[model samples]
Target: MKIYVVGIGAGSADGMTFEARNVLEKADVIVGYTVYAELVKKLFPEKEYFVSAMKQEAERCRKAVEMAADGRNVAVVCSGDAGVYGMASLVYEIAASYENVEVSVVAGVSAMLSGGALVGAPLGHDFAVISLSDLLTPWEKIEKRLECASAADFAICLYNPSSKKRHDYLMRACDIMLKHKNADTVCAVAKNIGRDGEEYAIMSLAELRNYSADMFTTVFIGNSMTKNIGGKMVTPRGYKNV
Candidate 1:
């Protein structure tokens, strides 16, 4: 029995990788978060689905593993690359306790990459990805990471920027970044990437501090070397000087 932990990409079938689609097609069961499951449901409605609400990650993975151990091929889906804050690790951890269950991870485009393309190439140079959700990680640790990334002038990609309960979290992060970056630093936000009503905006760090975002938004803050090129956010890789 084998389980495929697949990355469905940024909430659209067009964004899914060929390998990921094939895995899902061959799997006997599909398990994922409620929102992710819904997205895949439209693509592969014939497959059996096991959907769970948020914060039930452990239960979801356990169910996938149990089904796989019963000699059924299973696919556990996650938005974005499975290795990045997805179900791949959890599935592996749980599958370790079960015998005869193989695990295969299929990668896909993450929000940072998809969002970056929509707003130009702000991540051409070295960058950092940070999640603003403090559910599993402490706020202090996130603050330190933001500070370090800012001081190093790394282009930053933020995920899970805000939700109803944490509306001010993105603003707080912007404030921390302001201390290390200039007020005019180029920033961008991509909403509903690769899906309907997709929209993006480029602005300054000062303007971004007051910007509103939701769980579906991805934020990008450029480094000191970033600039606006033809109204697009861009960070040079310095290949021109070579």
Candidate 2:
């Protein structure tokens, strides 16, 4: 039994890579969060589907494994890069718990990458990806990582920025970043990147503090070198000297 954990990249069919599309086309069943399941359903109208709510990681992986054990070619769908804050780890964990269930991860463009592209090359150099969600991790730990990343001057791509229950975390994170970075530091928030309702707003760090953000938003905090040009955000790769 084999399962392909494929990242669909922000739930846009156009965002799916060629390899990922091929894997999905060959899959006997598709398993994923409800949103992702709906996105891919039209493509595989005849294929069987297994869906779980958004945050049901353990149950989702267990279901995938169970289906695979029944000799189904299941494709566990994820938004953004499966390996980047997606279902890849959960699938691997469940596979490791059992034996003989073959699992493969098909990478997709992460929110960091897709959102960065929407706002020019904000991640032209070294960067760190962080999630603001404290459900599984402590807020103290999340804050520590943000502080460390800031001190290191690394470009930061933030995931799970704001949610219904966790409303003020994004603003708090912006305050922390402002303490370490200048007010003029470039910052951008991309909402629903590569999907419907897609939009991006580029601004300075100070401005970002008051910017409207939601759980669908991916925030990019630039390094000292980042800049905004012609309404597009960019972090120069430093090839000019060469």
Number of the top TM-score candidate: 1
lDDT of 2 at 110: 91
Cα lDDT tens digits for candidate 1, 1-242: 88999999998898999999999999889999999999999998888999999999999999999999999999999998998989899999999999899999999899999899999999999999999999999999999999999999999999999999999999999999999999999999999998888999999999999999999999999999899999899999964643
lDDT of 2 by residue, 153-191 (tens): 888999998888988898899888777889889999898
TM-scores for all candidates? 0.97, 0.96
Task: Look at candidate 2 and tell me the lDDT of residue 12.
Answer: 73
Find the 10 residues in a row with the least total lDDT in model 1.
233-242
How high is the lDDT of residue 20 in model 2?
93
Which residue pairs in model 2 clash with each other? none
